[model samples]
Target: MSRRWSLRGKEIAVDDEDVVPAGLPERLFATDRFPCERINMYSTIDFLLCVRDALNGTEEMAMLLRSCFGTLFRFPVRRVLMGKVIHGMLTRQVLTKKKYELWPVFGGNPFRFSLVEFGEVTGLPCDEFEEGYSIDYELPATEENYAYWERLIGPDRDATIADLVAMVLGDTGMPASRKLRLCLIIIVDGVLVPTSQIQKPSLKHVNLVKNIKNFLAFQWGRESFAWAIRTMKPCPKKLRQKTLRILGFPLALQLVAFELIPHMQG
Candidate 1:
């Protein structure tokens, strides 16, 4: 009689005399879900399996990626979609980390998974994206497509827009609230866009300059950018850098949405 425990969400067992139904593969052991929960353990593959299971029976991932990404839209499609996707993917993993740090915003390479994978899977026309990092891609407008998208995205677009902005900002060095404000500015100030230009990109839609700017003004007061800056506090160097890459680099996206040429000086 030996006490057994599960490991890494996998249904295997540990400790002395941990045998299964006696006739199974000698290499495998059995641990029931109740016991596993009692011991608090799981396998990495088990975790992935769970994710796979959750995503079963539908192509939501592909559809969301395609809808939010693909051709440029008048709203920030990638921004919104990326947040939801990352939130779904990372919340579980984040809970598992023994040592976790929660900043006002979450910033790191972890949030970039969907974008990186999307491009690889779609075989999209990313010609303009080759020369720069994730933040430098652009989204060109198409009037007919834009109108179709507007009708398709519908009224909830604003809520979705806010989510993406928050996620990206959180993934950056800025505070969650500030990330919201700053992202809004970048959207309207003509800094953010969804283009294939980034070495790896997350956003698949673009924002309108007037809409973004006006959104910023309403969201952040007259000194919105400056006010958002005030909220910045110190984080560890490693975390800070990660945040900047996730949040700051995407500032290049603003240029695309606005259709501005980066090299030209006013």
Candidate 2:
């Protein structure tokens, strides 16, 4: 049934089905969408899911994966720890090894990667592998992603995470994704020198139900924070130590004990 008339300003309503509700955060992203690659909340896992779904010919699953980004892209910051983790993941992406060097299908220009210098074998027998390798990059903007990120963030710089959380929670009119990207940039660069990390108090309102570290530890389980720290930037010793502790020194020790101690002759 058709509505009698659509109200000009008030007719539009929130789609009850969508995860993110209609709100100011929606308006913010609507103003200017993120230009570069935007990862799903599950990120690499989401990419794997898309690839898996595509393999299974489940088009709708790809759509579902596309829709699963973290809610921080909307209004106030909710999952602070998740936000930080995402920021770390994005930062890791920021400094990715140039893949085009290995796979010419990226199509920008020929370049060499220090890690895998195979020289110019453009017309050689080895070029067959490039075709197989290119299959792994079926998604759009596969390598251009690195270029877009390179432009958005510079090496040895700080991302705007704290300010972003502050803005989203405050009365600011900035896009949440943009804020998160800025934070990612800082996190990517934050390793060089530790700026004041996000204020824990500000995030207290977000996940009050669980202890943040415990929750993250449950998720990270056996992984060490060293990887995050290395990507975020090397900091002062105290800051590094603090990061290690926050990232999960106890869990790390447990992993080491379980895997290493059992094997040691001592």
Candidate 3:
């Protein structure tokens, strides 16, 4: 049996055979000094800084490219696929309902752009689900369609999205959570449409991953802080202050805590 990481209560086997030198994963995530513990904070800040510097002409495209490579270092390709499926559904479902109107919300805004990106996420045409729903056989599957679909679906879509959304929402069966977050992130950040969307092998997939990583990291920190500030009702009088002081409060962390604690309490 291989060592594995348990994600959303599922055991995913680790392919690498290298033996850990005892307590590595725990130490990496648990310790303050270990890079993984604070990697999100610094990496997120650095990712933003790189973009800023690029826009300011202080950093050239070559330098930004190098930074981008480093920023994505060790990012789980599987997670990206999961996110793609979650967003893909939101896009396809809404588009099917109304070709011109973006569902979950109607606006010519950044959130709306995310729905448009659904096509890129699944590597299927925006009309796939609609065609399926209508039982239309007008669209033929080309070699490119098969290839892209293979890449997008990988092992599965619905199953993977189910797990990923559960992790993000702390819900047993909340289908709307991931889509809601994607819309909120786009609206809050007001991300511009990438020029690469027009090119072959569109950048929508690439940027989608980056956007999700940033949004999750930021939310994690935010929620952590909110958890600290909000007092627990019916707490022990003797330990109330101490409990508040020790909370790992950050804004991102608060959002995560809000999502998780309800499930935990239940």
lDDT by residue (tens digit), candidate 2, 1-266: 22221111224333343212222121111222312332122111122222232223334333322432211122112212332333232222212232221111012221112111211110101122323332112234334433443333333123343443343335245443343333332222222112233321112111211232332222121111322233322222322232322221111112222222233212
Model with the higher TM-score, candidate 1 or 2? 1
In model 1, where is the ten-residue run with the lowest total lDDT? 34-43
Please provide, for model 3 over 202-232, each residue's C-alpha lDDT reduced to its tens digit, 9 standing for 90 to 100. Answer: 2223233334444333322222222222321
Write down the TM-score for model 3. Answer: 0.17
Predicted candidate 1 versus true structure: per-residue lDDT over 163-210, tens digit per residue: 433344345343433333333323322222211112121222333222
Count of backbone clashes for each model? 24, 9, 22
- How many clashes show up in model 3? 22
Which should have the higher TM-score, number 1 or number 3? 1
Candidate 2 lDDT (Cα, 0 to 1): 0.25
Off by more than 4 A, model 1 = 1-55, 58-128, 131-134, 138-145, 161-203, 206-266
What TM-score fits each model? 0.20, 0.19, 0.17
Q: What lDDT would each prediction earn against the true structure?
A: 0.26, 0.25, 0.26
Best TM-score goes to which candidate? 1
